[model samples]
Target: MPINILMPALSPTMEKGNLAKWLKKEGDKVKSGDVIAEIETDKATMEVEAADEGTLAKIIVPEGTQDVPVNDVIAVLAADGEDVKAAGAGAGKAEAPKPPASSFETPAARAPQDEGSAGGKTEAPTKPTTNPAPRPEEGAPAPVSKGEATHNGARVFASPLARRMAKDAGIDIARVTGTGPHGRVIARDVEQAKSGGGLRSPAAAPAAGPAIAPAMSDQQIRALYPEGSYEVVPHDGMRRTIAQRLTQSTQTIPHFYLTIDCNLDRLLAAREDINAAAPKDKDGKPAYKLSVNDFIIKAMAIALQRVPDANVSWTEGGMLKHKHSDIGVAVAMPGGLITPIIRSAETASLSSISAQMKDFAARARARKLKPEEYQGGTTAVSNLGMFGIKDFTAVINPPHATILAVGTGEQRPIVKDGKIEIATMMSVTLSCDHRAVDGALGAELIGAFKTLIENPVMMMV
Candidate 1:
């Protein structure tokens, strides 16, 4: 039997990916865990490992194929001792290896409960661990195309991984209906379907409410511009993901802004003193060059610890109060921006934070960051101070209760004992998720941040 090589989902929010290149050609010997191909997700290009040991019988989805949906057959492999020629000839004709229909059967007969999809998602889906069998069995069940059902000219909407799971488990995906967004099947649904229950028929699904009418179509938007006046530039994976996540953030999270002015004279003086004392390497490069943003990050992290009530995430089940301050710092890239987190920022030294951010920013621009490096965080910081921006508010990224936006530090006149004096001042805005942090709680959190930021010495204690 020919083993189907489907596209793997590299991350939780990944739906489609670009098949960048294939390292092995057809008729080549491949072993389990061998690197076979490269898959380009939203921000990173990861190497795909071969799950089964066999000969590459066929190449179905060639390299450079863009927007390839997950779980679609990309290649075919023949098991060792099998007729490679016949396997290559049959290639895609062979159905995927499904274990048993009973695998999807369950003890409890109920509809699959997918919290994010059944109603709506509080956050993105969790990445599933997919370890496919390395060999083919003697007998497998008949397969359905991409987990589709045969009825009413209707098609099944399922994530690529769900379809693959159904095929591998010999389950009739049509019988195990979807509970994901817009009735699409997801990994959790498949897991619940394993019990031979918690699945409904596709025909029983509720009808779609209406077409996506709130937004204009691509064609209509294009028509507004004069013909040939502009050349169309398509969005890549990063841009698309950014647009989607930001849109979701703005729509779902009710954001409130709190702004305050901080006297940066102390912080600026402290940063210079710390940088001047930093140890230098043989190449004359300083071990650490602390920046004002580094102080802000440390201050915000400690402030969250002081005002622990504001450090929370809102879920339908309950509020999540994190123990550590995982501070995600926004780093601008060509297509968009990425937020790489500094784990346990409250405990780390300013030098460590600066060093880690420099490395993260360099790798992030090259699209070399792993998903875990940028995924979840208790809060975030977005500083446009380097760009000379006075002040601006930021959108609340989900799973985070608040984000602190920093503006440039410049000389401003201040009154001291009824006498005017010039002092370095910076403006900071805190965007809070109202559901998680109320006005007073947010104010308290920001106040703590202001205190620490203004008195640079306090952060050390």
Candidate 2:
């Protein structure tokens, strides 16, 4: 049998990726665990390892191909002793078998039920009974459903039996609540929906006028400007994903920002002293040289520890309180920015944090980070001090309750004990997800950070 190689999902939320490059070419023999290609996700570019030992018979998707859907076949491999040419010829002819039901869900199939019921009820539908109708064969095609309705522009998923019941009852299948596996609407769900219960209307669809006007097409926008006045730069997969995610975050997450000014004189002095005392390596380079950002990271970590309530992520189920501070530091790259995390920042030493960040920043610029290096974090810190940006709020990244934006440190006059004084001050803004961190709690968190940063000795304690 000819083995098909599908594009792997680099992250939980990754639906598609760019086939950045292929390490193995056609006719190359690959062993299990051998890296065969590099896949570019929104956050990073990762190497994909082959799972089967075989000869690469054909490359269905070439390098630099963007937006390749997950599980779509990108290559074909011939088994041992099999003819490579014959396997390549059969690639497009034979369809690959469907994966297990647990792993074969589409985005629409896993969407949550719509808010606002017919009778002002807001409770979710109860789970359906376990005595489901006998499922088809493991590899059998799923039965088709009818009535096209969209949630977030994706088609709704329902069992064929549910569609039939919904059609007969004059109920919209999209409005019927799905309680089956991965929220798939089954026959019983549709039957229950007919009784004016157990159904959820599409969240994106409004009962009155359209929820939102459609965006102008590219051609329409381009027509407004003179021809040859501007050059069109095609969007890469990363840019598209970033735009979609940021838009979704701003729209869905309620953000509240708090700014604080901290005196960085002590921190700067401490950093200089610490760097001077650092040990040298075999190359005659210092083993560790800490930056102000390192102190900022440590301060934020300790602050989260002091104000544990602020270190949380908001979810539909409940607040996720993290025990450790996984601090993500935003690093700028060619196309966009990425936040590579230093896990357990509270536990790691300042020198360790500095070294780790140096490595992450270097790899980040090269687009060589792994998914785990940049994916999830309890909180984030974005420093634009180097670029001379002062006092700016950052958008709250999802799954992170707060992100601290640090500005450049400069000398400024200050009132001390009713007298005038000059001190090095840095302005910092904390952008919090209002759902997760309340205003008072966010203030307390930033206050803790300010205290640790100003009194660098306290951070050592």
Candidate 3:
């Protein structure tokens, strides 16, 4: 049999991906585990490997193809001793592999079952059908009914997995309609039936409303402006993802802002001393030079620890309290920005944080970071100080209850003990998720941060 090479799912949420490049060409003898191609997901580019040993018969979906759906055959393999030309001609005809068993299991799989009482009316548990049914071809219409009624009685024709799920959900499998090939009930049907038992087909289920309003088409918007007045630059994948995520964040999250001004004289003085006494490397360069942002990251991490209640994430189920502060620092790249996290920032030394951040920023601009490197964080820091921005509020990234916006430090006069004094003061704004951090709690967290930032020595403790 000719083996089909389906597009692999690089990430859980990935439905489609770009076939970036092909490492192997047609007619190449490929073995199991051979690197065959590169796939570009929305977040990262990953290498895909071959799972079967065979001669590369054909490439159905060539490299550079965009948005190839998962489970779609991208290539074909001529099995050993099989005719290569025959396999190439029959490419894309192989059946897709079954989905993982866990995807079929619903929440009700672990629910308590109601056993019959001593009323002597024990109902037999429904058993799943052992024979596997053929799957429907792509674009094939779904069957009208799930099962057929024989002369003896009505019989439920469902896969073993689907029947098990229906039984776990306490739903009558006979009542659930099937959309699989030849009117067979499948796992998806049973899973969808849990909410309202067999009331409607999956196709008939109500569609969810869009989270954000649709944008105007390019042609529609361009008609408003004069011709040649402006150039239309199309948005790349990175920019599109950034715009969508940021828009979702601002619209969905109820953000509350709190600003505080801190004296940075001590922090600057400490940074200079620390840099001057830093160790040298083999190249005669300083081993590490800490930046003010590093201090801010440390201060924020410690502050979250001090005011633990403020370090949380809001979910529909409940609040997620983090044990350590994984602080994501916004690094500006060519097209946009990415937040690479410093895991357990509260425990890392200033030098270590600075070094890690330097590496992250370099890799981030090159778009070489893995998804996990920039995905989750307890909180985030967005510093526009380098751009000469004084004070600004940042949008709250989802799953992070707060984001600290740092401003540039400049010499300013302050009244101290009824006298005037000049000090280096920096302004900061903390954006909090209203649901996770209340007003008083946010204030306390920012106050703790200001205390540590103004008194740089306290961070060492």
Model 1, range 134-180, lDDT digits (tens) per residue? 54354442233443463344555565567678889988776665544
How far in Å is the alpha carbon of 76 misplaced in model 2? 1.8
How many pairs in model 1 have backbone atoms within 3 A of each other, for residues 3 or more apart or on separate chains, i.e. clashes?
11
* Structural similarity to truth (TM-score) of each candidate: 0.75, 0.76, 0.73
Against the true structure, candidate 1 has what lDDT?
0.76
Best-to-worst TM-score order:
2, 1, 3
* Candidate number with greatest TM-score: 2
**Across residues 327-425, which tens digit of lDDT does each residue of candidate 3 receive?**
999988877788999999999999999999999988888777777788779999999998888999999876699999999998899999999999988
lDDT of each: 0.76, 0.77, 0.75
Angstrom error of the Cα, residue 104, model 3: value is 39
Q: Give one clash count per candidate, in the order shown.
A: 11, 0, 1
| Model 3: per-residue Cα lDDT at residue 305 | 98
> lDDT (0-100) at residue 201 of candidate 3?
41
Candidates 1 and 2: which is better by TM-score? 2
